[model samples]
Target: MTDAVQQKEANTRVAWIAGVGASAGLGAALARRFARGGLSVAVTGRSRERLDAIVAEIERAGGQALALPGDVTIESELAAIARQLVERGTLEVAIFNAAGATRAPTLDLSAGQFEAAWRVTTLGGFLFARAALPPLLATGRGSLLFTGATASLRGRPPFAAFAAAKAGLRSLAQSLAREFGPRNIHVAHVIVDGGIDGERLRTSAPQRVAERGPDGLLDPDDIADAYWYLHQQGRSAWSHEIDLRPFNESF
Candidate 1:
């Protein structure tokens, strides 16, 4: 049988998450949720150790997962991620969760730093969509979800690079949705407006956590649910974009 045929016959409950590490973060939470729901998740990121750790967690939960370490900004590596997923089974959901966050004032930002943000945030999304489209289109119905932040909608001072990159990603999602919605594919962008309640952030930005107050941070599991909801939305009345934030967050 052809590889494609074999893959089709293999477990087709495949979901691809890019740019998230395996532990105590959005990626880990998302991988677990999909795994529990019976989808084999393929997770990619820059850290092999973290990805492996995540895979172990899923395996322990009786959910199949694959850990592939890669840089989202690299085209060849990104393409490999898609190929690996296709080898496993049908690519039912492809999530562009990678982003670059080099916060700095415009006056102090170096050219290289600015470009790096775009490379991962904007160009990375483009390449991921490009790589995932064929497999997704083959299924005739799949979800392409991009995770966005408040920066996606506003260019705040001291976050020019990050904001610009996020804005570009949002724009790309809109364009793809318009062009491909009629083709039976769902493309949605989610705006995550507040700080995420994750171990990584708590350790790194304790002050921000303290400032946000009790229940002020966004939950990763909650965010993952939103993505799954987008994936399962009725194609007839699909949502192109949704903004999620803590109730206490300011607009």
Candidate 2:
């Protein structure tokens, strides 16, 4: 290859998306989408077994992937993942999707319950963003996307803990977007305002799941497409937030 071709290959961009939960159909779909785009991906989560499985699937589809097993709540683990990625090259995009939620009356909720939700929903995102910042800044142009829920923007009873944590994440996104935009880093928040079709829903309420229609429920691939769009946006036309829902789903 010519020197120019070699230089271009050496500067190839990679992306990392943290969080691959048990019911991570969305994450998996996003993996496939990125892989198809010819970008190497590092998928992070707490379970090595699950992460390995996802890597295998991505490789089988002719995509390059690395499985980095770690908990977002752990700082050391997050730092280690960042180091590994830096060794490979610059990270062009980082998506924070590691979060958990619980539904219950605020008056009846326990301290532990609230703490767990906050740790994953807000604290985890904070740590992940901090760990990924250096690499993004080094690249000079990158994208930081945060996956959020409708609760992040709206308050509802029986979802106080989840809502609070999500609200905090939204605020963080806004602050970071302003801080990072001048640095050539685009920070955006994605609000998923509807249910995602997954195996759990299939088994729990098959009829309702079917009623959501083929395209009536949000798909991880669709969300991944949105992420890609934001990543490719020019600095002059950057978007700070985007809301996605099923075509027929009521928001």
Candidate 3:
């Protein structure tokens, strides 16, 4: 039988996550969670080394995963990755977990820096959706998930660029939901409203991590669980957006 035919017969489902960074980060966590759920996972990022590390860990844990390293901001690259995913199996979920930001005073923020943030966060999301949605529509079932932040809700000083980018991504998710939900495609925007207890923060700001204390930051695993839950939701009660934060979080 043809591979496509075999794929249909086997009903193999795949999940594709973009913007994977360190193994201890949310993108890697999401990959591991989905793979453990019996779905083959494809992870993409600019850092091939990091993506490979995440794939290795997932495979070590007896979960199927592969690395597809590329720039999320590049449409051609995303299209190629989408083709690769189609060859592997039926893509049931596509998550845009990529992020970019420039923390500076509004007056000091360069226009180029502002555009860069939008390119990575918002435009990257748009390109990924265009590439991923075709295959998803072919199956007539799938989920397109975007990762947002507290910045998605409001703009804070020194984070105006970040906030604008995230907010645009959130709106894109909403528009996608309205356009595709009726076609049985689930689109969700997850607003991560607080600090994440990930490698980046722990390494960059140890003092901040300590200040947060126990369970003060959002756990990547817990966030992954929520994404899994969203995918498993029945169409009767679809959720378009959800915010996540630690118990001690002010917002």
Clashing residue pairs in all predictions, respectively, total 0, 0, 0
Error of 1 at 85 (Å): 1.4
For model 2, residues 45-89, the per-residue Cα lDDT tens digits are 887887888888889888889888888998989999999988666
Stretches of candidate 1 off by over 4 Å are: 1-9
**Cα lDDT for residue 43, model 3?**
98
TM-score of 2: 0.91
Residues 3-96 of candidate 3: C-alpha lDDT, one tens digit per residue: 7788573487899999899988999999999999999999999999999999999999999999999998999999999999988889999999
- lDDT of each residue in 1-251, candidate 1, tens digit only: 88777856475778999977747788788888888878999998898889999999899989999998888888898888888887788888889999988988899999999999999999999999998998999888889999999999998889999999999999999999999888988999999998999887899899999999987999899999888889889987899999999979999
Please name the candidate that would achieve the greatest TM-score relative to the true structure: 3
RMSD of 1: 2.0
The superposed Cα distance between candidate 3 and the true structure at residue 20, in angstroms, equals 0.4
The C-alpha RMSD of each candidate to the native structure, in angstroms, is: 2.0, 2.9, 1.6
Compared with the true structure, all predictions reach lDDT values of 0.89, 0.85, 0.94
In model 3, what are the clashing residue pairs, if there are any? none
